[model samples]
Target chain A: MSDIYTNNYVIVAIFLILGVLLPVATVSFVGPLLRPKKPTREKQTTYESGNIPVGDSWVRFNVKYYIFALMFVIFDVETLFLYPWAVAYKELGLFALVEMVIFISLLIIGLIYAWRKKVLEWN
Target chain B: MNTLLQQAPSWGTTLWFIIAAVLLLAVVLGFVTYAIYFERKVIGWMQLRIGPNRVGPLGLLQTVADVAKLLLKEDVRPQHADKALFTLAPILAYAPAFAVLAVMPFSESIQFADLGIGLLYYIALSGITVLGVITAGWASNNKYSLIGGLRSAAQMISYEVPLVMSVVGIVLLTGSMNLEDIVKAQQDVWNIVPQFIGFAVFIIAAQAELNRTPFDLPEAESELVGGYHVEYSGFRFAMFMLAEYVYMFGMGALITILFLGGWLPIHPSLDFIPGIVWFILKFSLYVFLQFWIRATMPRLRVDQLMSFAWKVLLPVALFNILLTAVVVSYQNGMF
Candidate 1:
């Protein structure tokens, strides 16, 4: 059983390496060989319609995205906890169901808080 | 495949895995190639146009020729772009998209990885692609690209919560995260019957996760101007496109496994047919639905997208979990 477990991960690791290698070989190596390299000044400018781009794009912008990320982290962590309990629900019985109910209700509370606080709003 | 896994760790097993991975990669590539072709043909037919009939017969090779054109074009990099991230972004995006397939059980014997946490593995790895999108936007030094990247990131993150929650009911019912177990759990009746709400939330969130139409505000060409990959060209751009289509394939297979009973025949009498054929048929239905919806639906407003995920889908998904738990426990004689 454990052999099957370890082997499952080993295959995944191999697939990961091959995944990266396939694109790198094709996009970086095989691609550059066939593609042109002419680099005029105008060709290298940041594309923003026909107009020349003004200033840098990496400027500090919206804080709303940060709020959304915060909410996602909270919910995502809560969801992760729910997974294990879920998988073991059949063995753990009604007691586990009750516990998960409290847990998920707590999550619902957090979501409701975010909604009430307007953290989920995108203006 | 299970037999090989049951054996002790050996060089032979690893070698077989590599060969399988390579073959699966080719299969995924073939699926993507045709998916794009069919998406165009399907959408074009909807729009009253012929759509790429100039390529190979019935426009079969249109995507191939387009890929060739993209490959041979100039590999452009803006002068002020962060050279490293610009180059690395595509690999990061494409790798995880492909890597998630490691856990995808195509047919029982054809599965590559049988990770215990197969479902979670897919969701977790797929999340990494969002980083690459954000990185490409920040690295591009283009204003539109940054906004598009951030918009897509927000959209993805918003939908991800519901997407993950939507599957909790399936895990609760099957009592295992291994996708094979989930499929087997549905041997009687598919999860779609009991878990219809999950199926609905999942399919909707999945559409948003893939950044397809209705949720395609990130790449609204009318505004963001080609989204995060605005500055990418040649094979680099192709990598991003490849990642999208490959992810579509992954999502389709996942939906089939979770709701459509993986490779199970609709009825026991139909067991004479191969499991893989049923798997492909169900998988094709999903892929075709994606194209059909893309042709039919318009893009949702950005605010509408965000609010819908949080206010509507999240609560509905949470309710689904509670509902599934109640039903499953009652059936298990725990009520």
Candidate 2:
């Protein structure tokens, strides 16, 4: 593994070239055989069954989803720290338990904010 | 297979590793292409439709043909897009996914860069892939693309926490972040049995991390219309797809390493296949499972997705980590 990491630029170049080329090679070799000629405007349109697209692809979404996502961000950060501490639970014992309580309490506070805003509900 | 290179001081060892990694990377890349073919085939089967039967035998070469079309197609760059970032974004999207191939323990003899903190590096590198999405979105000056990219960055970053936290349970049980070492730690029993909650949370979070279905709101086709890569054309789009599939395999590798016991044969007392074979089998199974989930489930609202990861998965992961640490210590007589 150490030896693998120690390889220099020429090695790197060869690897990079292989990475770039193999996909290209696969395409070149196999493509012509499967070639389907593209003709008219119909071929270019995005496929949504047979009907033409209803509107321009772009559409506005509800801002409430954004609010819910924002609330999730708050709780998720709280959870990440809990993982490391959980691993050390045996050695840390009571201290870990105490700390976790404090951490979760903060998350609960955020949950309260979401509850008050009714962000958790589906519209 | 673990034989040390006796003949090498510097040049020879370097030459050997370089040759081997190049060979492996080629194989892995081919596997990535085939994986795309496999995904289409399997998903088609699940959806009860024929996929790419005409492209090659079993439509095996369909991805190859599509690659050619992409290459031959005109490169479409939006006029207002930032030239530098637009060009650079694909690399950002792609490279980290490949770099993660380093820590995945395909075999005891395999693995390119087995750093002690392999999991940490994998997560860190993956997180940066989000930046590429944002760069592509913001640089494009296209509003839909901008919203898509921003949505992705926000969604991915939000879920990243639970993703890492879920893995913390396995890391706790094994007492090492080096994937190979962690697998070896699970020599007695696969961590999945002991850490089921962590396993479940990790799998869900990983699905979200890959921006996969049910959790794929970032590329939500209904409203966003091709989403973050909306403006990219030609090979740039191919790069994004390739990166995504590679990362899917990478996630499979991580799940296998931490939870499925890496290369350790599932059957005790009888070992026919090498550890590498087990690793590949397990990894491929998980990858297929991802496709299955995609086929079966409906996309969740972005809000619901985050709450599921944070409220549901996060707590479960923490609980598993705590439980594993205690159980392992007591059993080992550490207490």
Candidate 3:
């Protein structure tokens, strides 16, 4: 509103109009211009591309993937925080070192749980 | 915050904000558009075909054409779908792509935000995309989307660990979280020369995080039939496509920044190529390499995927971090 009311008004308003109208323009301009018009059952079908799609894609997955994923998120986030500590290493020194060790150790327990559960044992 | 803003130089801050936003938006939008094209071209080359030659010259404009076609298609929402969540999921999936770029340093001084806790912000923000996928998968109430979203949640969370650990070594060496500082440390020598193992681990984990190739169990067309996004059509579906390639380029850009020197050269003599150009070239190479790997490798079994991250990548990354700490400590003492 401020930009539209100020010296930047014209420029900002052009972008504003485009933002609202562009999608509408695209649908009309491009849809009819492209996509062949001879309506066939296959032409409109969700593109299996001449191959018959068999069996619904939804099926049970190994629940074990969930466990590993859970562990990954916890650890992934922990590692990310370490970047700041690494950067501030000079100012923080050994105090930072000790703090990181404690933090990493907490994440290691999740790793241990995965190992003990034998989720790591793949042939 | 208001007082701080009033006290500071507004021009430089505004300029940085604009530049960073432009770079971030351009990369996310441009990469997402072109990734589809690159994927087709690579796949076509492997299969010995011209590949979308009808669109623009050699199909250079094929993605634009495809995006246009998608926009025109019907955006069908299942009557049973939770309207609010259904409508919101694509934006949910896509918005994080832009947010994560806040932490990614395209070149020295070129970043959206230099929050002192940059790396942590990158990791934390990326996890938000999982919720978006889960939301899409759950809202559609399609069996396939539910399973796909479930698979995405599983795959990304699993891969995020090693990806973070891969950078732990670099952080140890640079002793700074500011991505620019990390890049500056590399002017003496790129971290890749010392942290080669970390670099390799990062690339592998990034591929998995972005759901490329073997780790793409979430969207495995042959198996789950388009996974979490199966119900989406037209522009909403295009949002998922956009989020995906943007994520890919984001990881590639992160890799370039963290491991490949973020536009620093092997020698000072090659400084003629501007830093941003060097960064972009490196990123493009990584993106191409991802396509190359996709054409060559087969998808892994679900069990194989979990075990590999837990047993293999985690161990290597942990070992790398410890080793880097010791080495960096010694180097610091010497200096």
TM-score of each: 0.98, 0.80, 0.80
lDDT, residue B119, model 2: 77
Task: Write candidate 2's Cα lDDT for B1-335 as tens digits.
Answer: 12333322366565665677666777767888888888888999998998888887878889889887887665566555677887778777777777666556688877555566677777877887888887887776666787788778777876787777777767666666677788888888998888888788778888888999888988898898878888777677888888888788778888888889889998766467787888888888998898898889999886687567556765666566556655766776655
Cα-based lDDT at residue B63, candidate 2? 84
lDDT value, residue B77 of candidate 1: 94
Tell me model 2's lDDT, rounded to 2 decimals. 0.71
True interface contacts retained by model 3: 0.23
**How high is the CA lDDT of each candidate model?**
0.92, 0.71, 0.70
After superposing the true interface residues, what Cα RMSD does each candidate give? 1.2, 6.6, 8.3
Q: What is the lDDT of candidate 3?
A: 0.70
Worst 10 residues of 2 chain A by lDDT: A4-13
The single-chain TM-score for chain B of candidate 1 is 0.98
Q: lDDT score of model 1?
A: 0.92
User: Every model's DockQ, to 2 decimals?
Assistant: 0.84, 0.15, 0.18
The residue-by-residue lDDT of candidate 1 on A1-123, one tens digit each, is 889888998998998999899889987789888988899999999998999888888899898999899889999999999999898888889898889889888878887887788887777
